[model samples]
Target chain A: MRMPSPKQTLAKAEMDMTPMIDMTFQLIAFFMVLLNFAETEQDARIKLPSSELAKPPEVALESPLVLQLTKDDKVIFGGELLPISGLGQPLSREKRFLELNGVDPKEATIVIRADGDAKTGVVQEVMQLCQENDFEIFALRAKQELAEEEP
Target chain B: MKLRNTGELSDKVDIQMTPMIDIVFLLLIFFIFNFRIVVQEGDFNIRMPVAGPSAASIDTQLPIRVRLTSDDEGNLTGIVAGDRKLDNFSDLHQFILAQVGNDAGPDGADNMEVELDCDYGLKYRYVISAVTAISGYVTADGHIVKLIQKIKLSPPKKPS
Candidate 1:
């Protein structure tokens, strides 16, 4: 049986959007927890060297220490310039503190982000310091793309 | 067929969009603040050849040493593998594979360890190319396998 259309139904159209809005909020929350801002700690002034053989480490360090080497021969640690020769004292202190806090110094990783033009010797000094402090793992940061070489 | 508006109803209830738009804007701002732009800086896990003078040394086997030398301008001048001067990255990869052999070790260990001694001045591009070449190989079945699983970095020699 064909019945007459209701006047209220023809006057307005309304749709529920609560489900979609809930999904959007969930996505936002997911990214907020996953994004690790500390990982992008490269100094803008330092141009990283590139390597084709360089692959991302299998496991990432939770609290890997960062050190930067500039072309001017300055070793920047935590934004303060430190002498290449004097890096040992602080490094040892860091290791000692890590030990006190129950973190094994041997398990801790140190990442070195150095400029290509920086003297190899200066970079080695930092590596040597890390080695002397009983730290085993070290990561040398390099850009993966060959086309992105800094002019 | 022409129809008449016989069932018209009041449509005066306007939905408020101001609060919904404000919430969306707030969510967008939150994402922008928390998002970290990852600079694809490949972390080449180059462990030191010698784990300092602390741990007792293991006499497993001698690693194939590939020395990379650079000029004062940080230009990669030479790539040498025990007296063989390789011109390109492919040669470096081939040379290392030739030395390691096609068959895996009896213990299923790739056993082919390479220690790279790279110049600090040498751009990372060269190092990575050489590393990429020597580390993995394409099998006859078209499968890729890493030839040299273990890689160690030799400390840079001081520039004279």
Candidate 2:
């Protein structure tokens, strides 16, 4: 019998790649779902501020209250154009979310997503309303770095 | 002795997938890294002042209310701290230090709260400046010492 060379012996007929490819596709899919490109409460009209001093929360805020304001001074909550005077009504509902989780409303956080050009007064009014509702924590949504300043 | 070549072996072909797998992994890493960049746009953290409408008496000293006013053309004209009008943010910081006193510990203003009141028509640049002034800035030694740790937004002044 003639001896086959080492090169010919080393060549395998097949290798299974199904598992790795499967896991890779799963990872890609998970990232795609987590992207949430369209379904955020952040309205394009609302230009956020930037802060280098801003730091990420040590604890994650679960289901935070979102208050969106536009440069035109139109405050929108729950898809309704909430008047400045009626800012309290939305919080009455937001507080219920904390209550459901058995967390005190005072301990919950409220995020103020305001436009860059939005009047300071409107932003303050929203905060005041959150205060009246007993929500103690407030997060002013802003770009943490200068890199995030791109439109 | 003569060896006969195997036809089946010569005809069989196997595709090499090492390069393809390597490329896919690179793509996977790219997406994973890009994920953090995308998530950064939406959320930021800040604290609220505890002195609300109902709790005025709870804390005797309220936060220093800093009202940011603008000109008719939407330019930042003045930074009003209580009844006194400050020339700029530097003055604002000096005023805060004067009011709170630089104890370098948990001895000033209790919670060291500040209320930032901005205008609706003004750009966010002015508001950001105020926030930075109130929250403190990076010193020459790269240390971040805050004038006030707790910050709140003042209610909007209703259109007269």
Candidate 3:
């Protein structure tokens, strides 16, 4: 009698990629949620002077001392006119008042908002007085669109 | 058991994956779709002066600032200190130095701080000149010198 024919072998294999695909999608979602574009737009119009040691200001929006300089050389503080000279005395007094009321002076920052047409002389004068008053942290206001213009 | 199964084989087997090919492709797609590339430029059309960092951090109490502007003929104009009108660089520098020298805080801190707000249309050379003059006000003895920080270059705004 002829020997039984060799049995044909059957091969069966399958891969389940559901776990890997799920992990990939999760990673994609993480990056999408954390990106920020508003920071680039916040100071577009303000042209900050370049310095090797210059750094971004550390002040927040609520407690900063806001100073605005107009093209006509008018100095506005929190929407009020500030005398061009001897501003340090009054500002220091204000700081003292804040401290008395429980605000920390070191946590306070001065914000400078100036027009492009403002003169260099005026800017220098303001800077000098701020230095005298001992205000350490400062923020320069600019439009966000302007920052994007740099290469 | 009718006829014994002579040729039957197992019907299921598991295969291991290549492990990282598809993950990389998905990552590449995610970045390409979500990335934001931007080039920033200021709306103010002014050139700014350069300066080194001050030796000391300014005091937080006194918030003195100077505002600079130019007339149609490019003549500098603005308030220097103490509400006085300033037309030239010499007066500006002297006023700054004096203000800083005499600054006395409640805690007896003599720290000084300054901000420069310059007009956008002004020339770069003029801005530099002003910065140079201001630097001289920082006394060499270190007793009268304070920090000059925050130079703002922007366009003039209309009064409200």
Candidate 4:
């Protein structure tokens, strides 16, 4: 038996990275396809109130009860203006209504999506209502980049 | 027999990429499922305040949340403590302090927790004023008060 020279040995020791590159490209494509853009746009009109102690919510869960506050202090939920002077009673009533309809109130977190120019009174009114409704988990929606400057 | 040596070589090489492709696909799926893309929108322009490192964790013993709202003129308008509405910030802060001072906890310090809910579009100065007022109430009498420690600032909720 004759042994191959150093040049032949070097040629046989080459590693082919084509498979690895292909796999990487495939993964990138998969992530790009599964991204959800609709949820990203839903809160586009919500300008969250800032705070020194505010932190981005730990986890993003589905089925959040979103409350949109307009500049005129009109509260819109599910594309309809809620007809209540204050947020407390109406929200409690709505949560009860959801529970009556077989929805779990505890599983639903409240997302306060307020217009930047909306009055603070309106926001508080809603928050006060949410508290009465037993909604403890609250998430204030804001741009991710802007959230970094919150604290 | 006449044999000649040639230096020609093919550029293509066959390599098994099934396992590598499978791993890449798995990673791509993981990120795709975990990636959260958030796009925020709202009418209010808010500049949130920052604080130096203070005590960690929320004081949940006497959690009394206060919400402040400003009118179109940027003046403090409404105040809410828990589910009750107060006339103004002064009243709200005084009420909170009174409650905290009365409660007897460990070390004789009040264990009241205060959470502030402010409007997004309200002037930062107004929020600061409210916060200052609340802080003052917590540290009154110069007796080394330590009841209320954590101050949580939250966004105001829209009325439903």
Best by DockQ: 2
lDDT of 2 by residue, B1-160 (tens): 8889654556557678888889888878877875733435434345555454445324535667888877766689888998899999879878877877754446565555677776655566677667777766565555567666566665556656
- Where does candidate 1 stray beyond 4 Å? A1-38, A50-55, A79-83, A143-151, B1-20, B26-42, B49-57, B102-110, B137-144
The sequence of per-residue lDDT tens digits that candidate 1 reaches over residues A1-151 is 9787686368555666778677777877777887776665667778877654455666767458788888777788877788788688888888899999999877777888888667666677688788888887777777764333335
How high is each candidate's interface RMSD, in Å?
4.6, 5.3, 11.4, 10.7
Q: What do the candidate models score in CA lDDT, each in turn?
A: 0.71, 0.70, 0.51, 0.58
**Residue pairs in steric clash, candidate 1?**
A7-B7, A50-B124, A50-B125, A52-B128, A53-B128, A53-B132
Docking class of 3: incorrect
Tens-place lDDT digits, model 4, residues B34-126: 667554332111212233323333344645777777665666678787888888656766776677667777632334556677765564445
TM-score of each: 0.69, 0.64, 0.33, 0.41
Against the true structure, what is every candidate's RMSD?
8.3, 7.8, 13.0, 12.4
Worst 10 residues of 2 chain B by lDDT: B36-45
Give candidate 4 regions above 4 Å deviation: A1-34, A38-41, A50-54, A60-63, A81-108, A131-137, A142-151, B1-72, B75-110, B115-160
Error of 2 at B158 (Å): 1.5
Which stretches of model 2 miss by more than 4 angstroms?
A1-44, A75-90, A146-151, B1-8, B11-36, B39-63, B102-106, B109-111, B116-125
Ranking by DockQ: 2, 1, 4, 3
Best by TM-score: 1
The C-alpha local distance difference test score for the whole of candidate 3 amounts to 0.51
| DockQ-superior candidate, 2 or 3 | 2
Better of 3 and 4 by DockQ: 4
